[model samples]
Target chain A: MENENMNKITINIGPVHPSTHGVLKFVVEIDQDTIKKVEPEIGFVHRGVEKMAEMKYFNSFMPIADKLDYISALNWEVLYATTIENALGITVPPRAVYIRTLMCEMQRMMSHLLFLAHVGEDLGNTTLFMWGFRERELLMDLTEEVSGGRLAPMYVSIGGLYYDLPEGFSEKLLSTLSVIESKVKNEYRAMSYENGLFKMRTVGVGIISREQILKYGITGPNIRASGIKRDLRKDEPYLAYDKIDFDVVTEKAGDAYARFMVRVNEILESIRMIRQVIKDMPTGDVKVKVPWIFKIPPKYTFVRQETPRGEAAMYLVTNDDQKPYRLKIRAPSFYTLQAVKELFVGSKVADLVAILGSLDPVPGEIDR
Target chain B: MESSDTIKGRFPTLLSDVPSTNKNETVILLNDKSKLKTVVGEIKNHFDILFMLMVVDKPPKVFEMNYVFTNYSKNDILTLRVNIDRNKPSVDSISNLLGSADWEEREVYDMFGISFKGHKDLRRILLPEDWPGRPLRKDFQVTDEVRNWTGLDLKF
Candidate 1:
């Protein structure tokens, strides 16, 4: 009778659990110790972001964009502002582009740091989490030093950034990057992939095929892990990415461990990219001259760039007004969340948390 | 009908079919309902990525749905738009072809009150289940009573 009851046990693991990292829930149907089916229950924290865009002016919507993926706030702001600028046929100054690229790369590093910390904590390695957060705090300080706010730095304006880098900004950022680079490497070697138990838990688990990745529209590090050599920075070349030099990391395994390793490698690459930007830092005007209340032309445009998780896309439709007629944010986590059902179908219940942590999804991006 | 012009030079159907209204992007208009699925399949076979699907509300009771496909190999984007009547807005769900369309179609259904036939899991995604009207529709009204967030008679 106990065995019979175990066959039909269904567990709902939060729109509010600590392991979720944000507002997201998974209804897992299990048989014995193995997961039979995983139903993703989302929209718990939906603020109607798309509908809100329709009411606010195009420029005013920047603050709202900051709320989507609050962890990587600059990445969200830059992508949306660049989309609007692209639609308006405006040219952002070279300095502005460089600054945007610097911030984007920094944001990528910060986001990966958070991912590392949380994934460590999820796997019961609390020491790695502390180390990860310590480095991430240094990055956050750099971000706040430049942009003013610690979390939602509404620094990137529509045409360009709100202001230029402050005094001693380069020195401060360089030191932080150096410290994080060495510290992250040390932590990875001591507590992460180099450790046997960590490898045992992550390797050959929650495997996804390359064909399935393509079928599901997966991008960013997730796609890269499946041996795909596509990076928006390298291919599309937005916001001074063309000028910067960095390698696109890949792992052929296409497993949870591969995803983790790919992200680990990406942090090093971001450090390299940021160092290049700082070394060749250009001096010019940061903000483009534009009216306070600018009206967009009657046209529709779709813009996308590589976010840390995947491809973050913004769709903008304007109707000769200061406000956008319609706006849609194609968040990467939203797409990645769907793949969980397929991933957890055959995995054991104990490995479910590991798989979820490996995905590194920001539920704000998913639920927004 | 195999002239030298026809043999040596076939006009680029993909380029010629693109509507002129698209300034920065290419838009394809599909009129035949029966060809919708096949056209999407063909585009998918060629492009290998379908990025987004959205419903556009055209004035005077006409709805236009767009399927955006981006070809990573060719570095080109093609958008297919299908028009339907607002009174009976329905379209065949392409979730079978493009995996990402699953939730996007559900979102369209929730917002625009359009019906996607053959969708496996059709339900309100962003809005509450008991929500009365489709908020994205032009006809949907938000009364003062409904807009009040903190009151005894608040209706969400």
Candidate 2:
């Protein structure tokens, strides 16, 4: 009896659980119900992408990049191609930049919608889950129409896109945006944002302070939710983000609710950006002529893109050849997953999945 | 907060001349690996965030480790490059200074086999601990079993 009272129970959560979002396992050390310590056991989906990138050609790595975060595959595609473009000093046309920006914002909205569905299920609310996916299908349709693939869109290429925006893309996109904006504001908002049960579960369940965000290197919506006014679009201004006008969504709470609210508002902001892109889209070639055998000089460069989850950066070092000497992908989920140790401590076992879902980590990127 | 150019100017002896890039990013090369921990500490005085740490295997024998830091207040980026001997690669750990470095350093240790002297719990984060040689190293070769299966002795 004495030994039982003294001993803390160790529970294994998963490399396959539904709430984990992906193959992420955690060994939770607990005493009765309170979580004492959580040691995450990741690397389940490590496909050796970095090692594989070394063997592939500089431009041939786009397909591999798409696998990193399939939720926002276009973002990864654009990021990889842009890094290569930066290294080789290839300039993309203004029309191409606007189209790329449009695709990126659309990816952001899709990712957030999926996250909303994930958060809903994690909290045992199937209504929000259903509503999220229902609204998400519209955006997914638009994505397929514009990018040529629904999930893994390998549309973005070095110097520009795989092809120009098809005729009537802007018109179709504008109508879809209005419908999404209304659904999100009227129907979807009530299910998660305003519902009593949803608020009770998320409002203050997993509070991530600003200090925790910086110390743990958490970025994207997570950092913005914690009241940090930092967005790569506004700060770094890659692509057509500099020309567009939209507010950076932020909340002061730094809790689960705040994270949810931030992403929701960001969907609205993305809608605004997409509208601006369609309105101001210039006329020109979508892609420039890049060499078939792309060779980079001896140099090192880092290119950053603000993804749905956070900032995705690529650090490339070339050795005066067609192949990259070294390429390191800095995925946002990698840092966010590490911060979970600090976030999970002192939280109840019941709230574990809720907290984990709110962070919105994709194992593909985390283990890459 | 001091700008990246100003900070790079202060330590001419410790750093090489700043390289010019099309993006106008300030890149400072550090020839000395021993002074890395102190240099990072100095950078922290101005830039509070260590944006990223990337290790590149330079083909014949050098290993270049880049520590990217950014001053959030000023939007200035400072990249510190440290060249380490491939045969004996080690650097003082800055995990004590920044909590973010704990996992980043572990990852560096795991992927490149470059030990961080003061990292509290240095273990493999991505690959299995028992996995053969550093996979990210340019000279890493496939095991005999893998080579026999593929009919090629793959070497990165």
Candidate 3:
């Protein structure tokens, strides 16, 4: 028998709100407080970065890349830089490679920290939010020490990085890492992870299957959480990842808790990687000079890199012009969000924010 | 690379019809736009995911559509390049074939104004519905009306 309360109704959640994160609108059709269909409307923040790419010169577009995924700005900067470098057939030196790698891993850690913080707040745990940001600020300080910019740092150039590390940067970084490692392992574990109520909120909820990962073209930590054992850093071996040794973490459950576990483990793994990069650091020139008005000869150049969110890639088609003929940015979140209907359909209305946080999608790239 | 050979071997009959160009061996040029579904359906098993859908405006006449397909197990990339006439450009949507193609085809339609005939919800996914002109198109010249008109009449 259908109860009086079991009628179907629609509820809209913000093109502007906290949980949806940066100008995303979600329409959830509910049947007795259970999600029947979830439709996420994107592009509230779309500035047409692709169209802007067609107008800007090869070198001029590097700073704009930082805007796409400001959470992990360095990764996008590296990706955009690598695209032009590949098109121009320029190889970055070993030192530059290691520097890019170190900075990228740090950005990954920063991204995950914010994810943990936001997800904690979503769960109504304000203490975890404060703790997450507390640890994240240390890394932020280190990045600012080098680049002098917080959040969206325009540190990477076409050939390599904008500048090399300072004299005591490595020493300061090692100290900062040690502090982060201890806090993450101890405080974070106690606050949210090991807490029974938190686990109950997350465990076995918002399950995205392995088949769905491939179907929706979900990548990065999202796919890894589903136990696919695929990471672009290991698979393609871009930057200095091939040289460094680290494990690609995975979980069989494909639940919200599994995704959370993957990000936490990945943070530790990134710390380990940073240590390796610092130790095996080669001394050489940080950047090679590429002209500002350079042109990539007529060709279709595609570059894919693993950002904190997912497999963010850029497809550039050049035709002997100062600007790209046509540029297409394949934001992984765009694909990741496509599976929202599948993820939300059967879940309780209260668990929506928890499920969303587990995915760790930033809308900057999605709306770019 | 052996991966290229493996690709050819994986789908022998299809490759024989559509020749791969020199820009990259993975890219296969499909001359017939109508046969997109049959070809995708046949090769769908080999390609685990539709990695990306890239539609380029080739200035004077053609709209070159590149469908990048990737296999997770084999770690291989195969691009199916299909070209359509610029005037009244339309093609069969492969959203039913690959779930990943759902949003991509919509995005292509929104930006390039290339209609995917069979897409279920074909509304503008990015720009305001009332916004004039396809912005990604090469001939997208900003008119006074388009530039100045505030997006207040977004009822559509």
Which is superior by DockQ, 1 or 2? 2
Tens-place lDDT per residue, model 1, A1-368, is 88777567898888786374787788999887888898888887777788778778787888989989988899999999888888788899989989899999999998988888888888898987888889889988888899889889998998899999999999989888888888778867778989999999899998887666766777788878878888888877788888878998999998888999999999999999999998888898998877778888888788889998887887777889888877878888887877887999989887887888888888788778
lDDT (0 to 1) per candidate:
0.81, 0.85, 0.86
TM-score-best of 1 and 2: 2
How well is each residue in A96-115 modelled by candidate 3, as lDDT tens digits? 99999999999999999999
Worst 10 residues of 1 chain A by lDDT: A15-24
Off by over 4 Å in 3: A1-6, A18-20, B1-25, B143-149, B153-156
lDDT of 2 by residue, A1-368 (tens): 88865878898999797393888999999988898899998888888788888888887888999999879898999899899988988899988888889889998999999999989989998887887888789888887887778899889888888888778878888898999899889988778899998999888888998777768778899988888888989988999998989999999999999999999999999998998898888998999988667789998777888999898889888889888888899998988988888888998888898889999999999888
Query: What are the per-model DockQ values?
Result: 0.46, 0.57, 0.62
Give me the TM-scores of chain B across the candidates: 0.78, 0.84, 0.81
Across all models, the iRMS values in order are 2.2, 1.6, 2.3
Cα distance off (Å), candidate 3, residue A297: 0.7
